[model samples]
Each structure stands twice: as structure tokens, then as C-alpha cells.
Target: MSITKSYSRPLDFKNGRIEMSYGAGGRAMAQLITDLFAAAFDNPYLAQGNDGALLPMATGRLVMSTDSHVVSPLFFAGGDIGCLSVHGTINDVAMMGAQPLYLSAAFILEEGFRFADLKRIVDSMAKAAFDAGVPIVTGDTKVVEQGKGDGVFITTTAVGVVRDGITLSGDRAQPGDKILLSGTIGDHGMAVLSQREGLSFDAPIVSDTAALHALVAAMLDCGASLRVLRDPTRGGLATTLNEIAKQSGVGMLLNESSIPINQPVEAACEFLGLDPLYVANEGKLVAICAAEDAERLLDVMRAHPQAKEAAMIGEVREDAHGFVQMTTKMGGRRIVDWLAGEQLPRIC
Candidate 1:
């Protein structure tokens, strides 16, 4: 029998709050899973009600990535913690040049959290997975005591497959390779900061949290000699580039003027005394490819809606010190060092 059908009373989603019983491995927990999570993320695999999902194996190299979302103020300008969790893990798999297939989510809900909010987050997560052609096949839930946890925290893991002959990694970059950015940087971080601090601006900044697998697929179809595909997330563009440089044992020369930044994001960073380069992003990506294929790759990236403003921001170079140097907009040279400390905490 279906778990939900076994329950005599329906959950009070409209005017209810989470309780410890919801995660106590009893009737309440089963009912919560069946009525809420299962109803929202309906899929054959999830319907099995098994301890773990049974997935059909696919041909190609498999890729798996997991991410935890704890962004303050669960809801933001363009997205919330739910969709952000989905996109974050999917982007991680896509960055490996994989086709994401399924997702597993685990939630930690604080006691006293409103059931209405939880439903919203789960529904949003389900929609994101559906739109991305991925399914949330299995998951677990736990409730913590109030004040012991945030309202809610979501951790998602995604699985994908990458066909043979497509090898992308951070260490594949070489001197003379071109570096490309998918779009404007720092949108997500600034958006969250503004909302958290209740700071209002004439032009509000929205988070660029989005699924990027389609963009990666388009780039692959263009047949460019791609080396690395990384979404600049927590550490933003500068830190991401530095990671690649260290992994590939190379240096980078970036054109500061060429990097894309929305006017509102730039203004907010200036006001907050934050550097956009070190700010976080959710939707944008950084690509490193052969210099000869730079233009071809750029064309394909720009063609995608997610990367319409893509640009070649820098180039890999030979440097024993593995430094990332940028030519300023005023024609000055400066070293774009690694982020010294945590710039924004709980920034997703």
C-alpha cells in the first residue's frame, strides 16, 4: 500500500509547522515523505519506495557531484535554496562534460519551520529537476531542534554520464590556451547580500542561478578542443582561474575590461567594499580551450541563452610561480591573488 494512503489524516500543509516526529522514522515521517516529497518529485524510480533507487546503467564514464545549500534568507531575487541546490549539483556534473541523469536530495529541517515554506522549496526543486531532464529519485529528511539549525538546509547529489573521448579537467589547460567566461560574475553573491542586509538599490541585482548543462552540450557540439569547464561559484572567477592555473601548473593573463559585470552588481560591490572578482556566482562558467579554437568555442557559447554575453577574458601562460595577473581597465597590471579569507559566509 502507498504510504500516504495508510495515514488516516492528511498533513496540515497550509497551517502547519515541522515537528520532530516528522523525522522520527515513524508514521509521521513516512507520511511526510509520501505526501510531500513523493507527490512533488513524482517519478517511477522514486515511487519504488526502496531504501535506495535502482538506476539503469548507461554507457560512458559516470560522473557524480554533491553540493549543500545554506544560503542565508532561503529566498532570493531570482531563485531560492531549492532551485539553487538543483543547479549547483547539475552544474558540477556538467562541468565534467557529463549528461546529468538523476539527483538525490537530503533535507535538514529545523523544528518549527513552516510546512508551507518546505512545500515551496520542494516544489521548486522538483520543477528544476524536471526542466533539466533530471529526476530526484531518492532522498532522506531529518528535523533538528529549533535554534540548533537554520530554517532548512538542502544537500543534493547528482549522477551523470560522459561519453568516451571527451576528457575535460582542470589540469588539461596549457600555456597559450584561451580562457572564456560564460557571463557576468558576482550576481548571486550580491543578490543574497542585498537581501540579507535589506539593502535597497535603484537597480536591484538578481541571482544568476541557472542550469548550465545545455550550454556545455552546445559547446561540445561545436567540436572545440575544450580543456576545462568550471562554473565560478563560491570563490568567483578569480579564485576559479587560480585553481586551474595551479592544477595545470601554468599562469594566466586576464583583461579586466573584457570581463563582464552588470552595472548593478558592480555598483553594489563598490558600495559594499567587495571585489566582484572574488564574489560568488551560480549560473556563470569558465572555459579553457586551445587558442586556435577560442573563437569557435566563443561563438557556440554566445549562441546559448545561458551564455549570451560570453567573452574570452584571458589566456593561459607559462609562469613558474603559477600567478594570475590581470591588466586593469586603466592599462595597469595587478596580481589577482587567491581569496585570502571568507568574503561572504553561507554564500551557497
Candidate 2:
């Protein structure tokens, strides 16, 4: 019997640095893909080794979402850019009351980037996808010249299937609806900012980055009375609510005291002269439902570990301008307008 020759040697992950040729679409690139990405994100669909996946779909409406991660200091207290990329896309898909099925990732790597770091990131991404039961079915990678790009940038696209008779949208909120929040806010933005600015607090504020599809599934079990669902991310709760207000053509009235915030996150925002309302949250979500179904939804949300602190923070109201108002603890009413500019840039 004749022995076949191997196309590539063992990768020197400990000491090897990424080279330009790795992205040149040759044996080197093939070796990287096979040895690293494919090995980490192993699944039946990905095992096909095709340019794209041929997915098997159930009877449902398809939902798709895409997101990019350029967060500074790729690694932070609780998570890194890798898991953030996966969780962000998963949350986006879950926001529409869909069951996420698969994911695709593309990486833009900088020349001279350490192979070990790249491996670490890929490992985290794989673990997140595996835990969420969502496989990464296809991917691509490229290297940019040194100084031309960040150490790494990741873009992810997710596809899901929504069951028949389930329709969720930003334009669905109506007057007299109740607004529910999953948990404390501002953890993600403050965590990344602290790492980037090298600021220390009384307690380490870790990012709340996590895949929220399971929690969403639990909420959907309560019934399909859910009108709007959103994961307050980049521009924070304020921006997300503003977008929903405009989309639904309704106004919102929030209770300032009802909104949850961690003590350390609150202190960090105060020290940084930031508003917790405008800070980002990775694992949390905003749910809107009819007045009668509010209690049932809250019960479902509170039962989940990720939403133990869930609260009914606001309600939808009729208004011509679609204003978002907050009732302060001091009994004063203030308009929670849209964020004037980027509150914290490069945040997921």
C-alpha cells in the first residue's frame, strides 16, 4: 500500500506569527483553516468543507442578522471579542422570537498578530457557539498589513427560523403595553471602557456578554403575546427604546427607579460622567407586551437565571411625537431623548 503525503506541517501555535501568505489562498491558508477554525468549530454541517453550508430548514419563517465587533482591548474582565461576536449576533436573532440555527464568521487579522491569541479567540468563539447549540457552518479569514488594521476584527452573520404564527417587530409596540427589562444595564460598556482606559473601581465590573436565545425561548413559552423584543446593545437602552418608539409610532413612559443597575456599574458611570441609561448591555433584553400579559411575562423572565432581576420598568403611551419620558425618583418627569452622538464607540 502507498502512503499519502500530508499537505502541511504541524502549526507552531505557541511561537508562530500570522504571515501575509496565510491569506493568499494557497496551501498555507488551507492549513490554517483546516488546523485551526475547522478543528475548533467542528459540526456536521461545517464538516462538509464547502464554501457555504446547505442548511436543512424546518417549517418556519427565516430570520437573519449580521453584526461586527471592533471593541477596543479585545479581551476584558468577563469575555473577549470572540464570544462577544457570537453572543451579539445570537441575541439579535433571538430578539425576533426565532430559534437560531447556524452562524458564519469572517476574520480580518493583522500581520504579525500572535498565533496564540488568534487561537484563544477562536476557542472562545467555538465554546460560545457550542454552548448555545448553534454551529458555525462556514467562515473566511484575511490578513491586513501591519498598522492598517486592528489586531483583529470579527464579523458574524446568524440565521434562524421563526415558527408560524409568531411575528415580532420593532413596529409592534402599542399604547397601554407594558415594557419589561431583563436585568441590570451598563455592565458591558463599562467593563470594556475600564479595560481600555486602565481604570480601576472598588469592584471589577465584568461584561455581561452572553447568548440570550435560551432565555428568549423561555419568554416565548409564556405565549406569543410578545409585541416587541430587543437586546439593548451599542447605543444602550436609550437608543434602542428611541428606535422602537419611532418604529411603532408610540411613546414610552419609564420609571427611573424601576430600571435596574449594578452598584459598581452605577459608580463607574458616575465617575466617568456617563449615564447608565445610555450605556450598553450584552446579555439583557427589553420586552414589550400587552398590559394583561405583563405579569405572566415577568414571571417567565424572573424564573430564568439570566433574568432574575427582570422588572417591569415602563409602559407604552399615546403621543404624536413618539417621545420617551422617564419618571424620576424625585417625582420629576424628564424626556429620555435619543443619544445625541456616540456614547461609547467600538462597543460590540
Candidate 3:
């Protein structure tokens, strides 16, 4: 008989708040996992109920990365905690020019989290992992008292293989390299903001959350000499570029009009006193490559479904101060400084 055969009870989610007993390693916690987590995230590996997963490793340079998701509202415009958790870590591993293989997720749930809602999140996550051709090989779960935990928090760790001859990093960008943005900016931030404040607008502001490994693979196939790869996340494109510029001892010059932003996102930033350049993004990425390869790289990016709106936003420059400046729509220039304060915390 299966070890979990005797474990059968519908989890009490209605009117039940998280208590210390839920986190305790006993019948209560076991029941919670058997009913809620194990049921929703069912998979051959997960169903095995082992402490860890044993698997085969691919031959090549190995790359691994981990990220934790705690985005507010749990569910949002484009995606929820489930898909975001998978995308965030997958992108991290892919940024290193790796093909992500396996994933492990750990969940921290607050007592009283609705079973229906939790199911939605887990199902979304499992589907993402499946679609990405990756598996959630192992996981752990813990329940905290109602007040002590958020609705849910997920930490995902991914392992992948780095394709030979494909090297990537932030410091690899060089002077005269071209900078390409995956697509429009600030979609993720505006979506979260709208939902948080109960605000509505004429044009819908959606988050640009997506998996980018396929896009990166396309670039590699196009023979582009990619020097660096970085996803513009919490601090947005401006911050990510600044970090790269400083690391590479170079400067950046951006064409304001060339960068793309959705109409609603632009208006929302104007109303909220935020800059789309500095707002958080989930689905966009920054690729720096040799100037000669810029056009070819752009061609590859534009051909991909995720990067159909790709644009060459800027170029690496020689600056003594390692500054990042932009040519505004008015034809005047302004220094794009590092973000001084948190624009939107808990965005990722």
C-alpha cells in the first residue's frame, strides 16, 4: 500500500485560521500537504513523497539559481505567484546562457488561506513547469499562523545546463556594444499598482511576465555575439543598465523615443509620478552585444513570439563617470541616475 493511502481528509479551509499546530510535524501538517499541496501539484516526482529527488544530470557546464516570490495580492493582472515563481528563477538561470532543466519549490502559507485560491496558484505553477519542459522534482511546505505569514510566499530553485561556447554576464558588456530591450516597459508594475489601489483606466495595463529562455536560444542560433544578458526587474531597465555600466566601466546613451511603452502604462506613470524607465518589469530583458551583431540580434529577437516588439534602445559608450543618459523627446539630454528610493516594493 502507498504510504499516503491512509491519509484522507478534506482540508478545513473554510473559517479555519492558521495555527501553530498546522506547522507542527504531525497529522495536521500531513493532512494539509496530502490534501492541498500534494493534490494540486500532483506529479510523479512529487507524488513519490521522498525527502529529495534523485535524477540524472546532463553533461555540460551546470548552472543553478534560486528566487523567492512574495508579490502582493498573490493574483494579479497577467499572472499570479505560481507562474511568476517559475519565470523568475527560469530567467535567472537562462540569463547565464543555460537551458533550465529542473525546479524545486517551497511554499509558506498563512493559516486560513483559501483552499480554492491556493489551488489556483498551485495549478498555475504546475502547468508552467510542465509547459517549460521542466519538473518540480522536490519541495517542502510550511504553514504559519494567520498573522505571521502572508497569503503565500514561494521560493523556487532551478538547475540548468550552459550550452558550450555561450558565455554571458553583466560585466561582459563593452564600450560600443548595443543594448536591446526585449519589449515594452513597466507593464508588471502598473498592473500591480492598479490592482493594489483599486484603480481603473481607459487602456488596460498588463504585466509583461514571460519565460525568456526560448528567446535567448533564438539569439544564440542567429550567430549574435552576445556580451551580456540581464533582465530588468525590480529597479527596471535604468537600474539594470547602470549596474552593467558600472561593472563594465562604460557609459550608456539611450534614445528616449525608441524605447517602447504601452499607452496606459505611460499615462499611469504620468499620473502616479513614476517613470516607466524606472518601474519594475517581469517579462522584459536587456541584451548587450557587439555593435556589428546588433542588427542580427534584433532580427532574432523580433522573430521570437516573446520579443516581437523588441527594440534597440541604447548603446554602450565611453564615459569617465560611467553615467547613463537619455536623449529626450525634446532633443535635450538628461542624466538617468540610479533610483534613489523604492518606487514599488515587493514587485517581484
What are the root-mean-square deviations of the candidates from the true structure over C-alphas?
1.7, 1.3, 2.0
Judged by lDDT relative to the true structure, which candidate is superior, 2 or 3? 2
> Could you say which candidate leads in lDDT?
1
Each candidate's clash count: 0, 0, 1
Error in Å for residue 333 of model 3 = 1.1
Cα lDDT of model 1 by residue, 1-348, tens digit: 665634358889899999999999999999999999999999999999999999998999999999999989899899999999999999999999999999999999999999999999999999999999999999999999999889999999999999998999999999999999999999999999888856645458899999999999999988999999999999899899999999999999999999999999999999889999999999999999999999999999888899999999999999999999999999999999999988988889
After TM-score superposition, what is the CA distance of residue 58 in candidate 2 from its true location, in Å?
Answer: 2.4
- Runs of candidate 2 with Cα error greater than 4 angstroms are 1-3, 197-202
- Each prediction's TM-score versus the true structure: 0.97, 0.97, 0.94
lDDT of 2 by residue, 94-124 (tens): 9999999999999999999999999999999
lDDT of 3 by residue, 1-348 (tens): 666656355665554545566678898878777776677667777778978887787988999999999998788888988999989899999889899988999989887777667778888987888788788888887888788888889999999999789889888888899999989999998888777745545458778888888888888788889999989988898999999999998999999999999999999999989998899888889999999999989988998999999999999999989999999999999998899989887877
- Which ten residues in a row are the worst by lDDT in model 3? 7-16
For model 1 the local lDDT of residue 248 reads: 95
lDDT of 3 at 49: 91
